[model samples]
Target: MAALQTPKFVYMNGGLTAWEDARLHIGCESVTRGLSIFEGIKGYWQPDGSFALLMLRLHFARLKRSAMLLHIPFEHDFDEFSAAIFELMTALVEPSRDMWIRTTLYVVEGHWGENTRSDLVLTAYHQDKALPEPVSLGISTWRQPGDDSLPARIKASANYQNSRMARIEAREQGLDDMVMLNQAGRVAEASTAALMMVRDGVISTPPASESTLESLTADFCEQLAIDRGYRFERRPIDRTELLIADELAIGGTLNEITPVKAIGRRELATDTGMLATLRSDYFASVRGGKPHPFAELTTLPKVSA
Candidate 1:
């Protein structure tokens, strides 16, 4: 895993600023009550040695939508936010660096039912670490809430506590990660990533309506599958589906395409599978080694090193 080494700069509140200078009051409602929404985005090093942010437009859209859902009162328009992020990415001395960016909007001055003040904080860091492949997984006892209970599509910081608990339990169980189910006893998603499985050469996953977060990576994979003539479907998945899946993998910005080697002694074939092919192609697309339609919208030209 990549350890955070504080970068020299950050964009906080209203402008580009010093990283160390950004601060939040200890007693602020957003800080104390977990009233915030954020997005995690990955930027890759292109073959031309310039950096290209993966799915930048989609990520910004989600961030704004999440803010709206949570009533965080984010004021900047998409163009403004995009320009700020592009400026930050170009300011890096190493243009070929792979990096992670997080943009957050939260309430800072509200109590209970009072009027709230909001702010934005953007922090980015070099992401040189590569996660290990063929990760082990365990099913968590924690059930993810459906949309009726909470907005499952919003990227709210408070919503992550559910995943955190599942992660803790997975650690205790000697697993790399955990899979969560929805209230209807249907497979939802992994703690931090979207889940996909293969059975009889067909790729299938639970739909977002089944309480899974709308996953950009998963959607990308689905399109990739369709374009390449591979079978893919979005439908309700049950717990028993995991046991019978011929192959399994998780998708996310950070996790990317990680094959599941085993799930509670039910070993999965990972050496040669459809997921392996998709993973390679996905990585190539992100790094600009292959043609991907989304790249045109997702990447911005680096103006300076």
Candidate 2:
């Protein structure tokens, strides 16, 4: 894949401004201490010369909750933020290409344990690509901590260190990614996605209590399964289940319903039966290729200047 160039303009601090000129102090806690909250959002180009963000409301709600959990002292009207994002897409991103949009809030002042000022940056760039092929996964020895250790549901920048460690280990093991277990030794989520396993026609995933992040993509897949009259549930998944399951799939803003071809040397089926239908429906919904039930969730309201 070619490198994606950042657009000349981005929404920063409350306005559509020049990207190169945006700055944050090096000594700020958000920069020095990694105290930042963010969201990963995707938009698909439609045939009507427009792009629609997937689950814009849900993403914005999660971003706000993450900021509050981290004590970043952040506040923003959702409508305003949504409008800003829409405006950025209109100005910087082309309507014919898929795009990834990110909104991050950071603390710009004070030391640890002190209240600080906050700043925001929203960016959009082209990300036209297909979902990845089935990947091989390795079970990481590193354990995902419980919510008491850190806010499990929030998408905080510091929390990704756990995933980063597992990712590095997976690379060393010659695998595509790693799945970390919870403190209870049960399967948690993959690095940045939620995991779902199929066994005897039943699809189940570990609950959020198992330290899985609240994943919008996972929710979408679960809804798709229900709407399609498939059996799906959220429950605890044992570590051994991964090796024995008939099929496994993962979902997130980046992965978007990718299947697992093998787990450490145990090869599994892919693009067959339920997993195949889920994958097909997922891409169709995100890319405007089918009648998507969640299309309204992606539509941004018209913003007047």
Candidate 3:
């Protein structure tokens, strides 16, 4: 029989508990109301065999911000959360080829109109041994919800249903992933990332106002474009712009710089595509927590700013 692969430890309310032991009854506020904030963090193995929890400080900051936006107050001490995360990572007797951690904060056991008190769940686990390589995506029938119509900016659990179903529909039709435009018919983003295009040396992205999730990865894309001596514009993007752009990429926690090889019948340029370049740049610095924070937006150095 193949060896068991499930992760064993998870940080629950206050301490580390066995993964199978971490459970909540059905009525938890986070479950019932979908009222939870989370960040997906990746850690890179350093040259010395130690791993740098790349962007540790940044992910926690975003988590805090999402919590605040959801009216679930948190007294976040970034330094402490950093220590906890690393401590949990260190406890692993057998770290995988790489690690991905879903660090989350939510209200415990309650429902509509219930007082929200926070609980934390931090789980670190192994993913498929293969590192992320560029993959294709499709145009999801789903449209991005407007900011007021939905809590579009927060990394709340409630929002993933849209992307989840989008991905499902795409695969059911035999595509990789899906891109979703906003209600305005403006190209908003992919199911879980920010989408951008490259054409005639200019980089273009849908404006955040179109209801794309405010993303750290998107900020990284902008910084990378400036460093690479490319131009950038964020405006309402026409759906056709994506189809005809010279290159296309999507940036997010797990799908950073995923390419759109073909959207329906339109094939993107394979030469020096935006996704290919971003694929190299995004992980190069962020993998081991290198570069200045301004230069490498995904990783740490969230010091005092």
Top-lDDT candidate index? 1
Where does candidate 3 clash, by residue pair?
Answer: none
| Candidates' RMSD to native | 2.1, 2.6, 4.3
TM-score, one value per model? 0.92, 0.92, 0.88
lDDT (Cα, tens digit) per residue for candidate 2, span 212-297: 99888778778889888999988999999899999998888877788999998999989797877988998787766775665343
- Residues forming the 10-long window of minimal summed lDDT in candidate 1: 296-305
What local lDDT score does residue 86 receive in model 3, on the 0 to 100 scale? Answer: 65
Tell me the tens digit of each residue's lDDT in model 1 across 60-170: 888888877777677788788888787776665365457888888868887873777888777888865365478899889999997977767998887788899999999
lDDT of each: 0.83, 0.82, 0.73
Give the TM-score comparing model 1 with the true structure, all chains together. Answer: 0.92
Which lDDT tens digits does candidate 3 get at residues 252-300? 7776566667777777654366557766776677554355465323222
Q: Best to worst by TM-score, what's the order? A: 1, 2, 3
Which pairs clash in the backbone of model 1? none
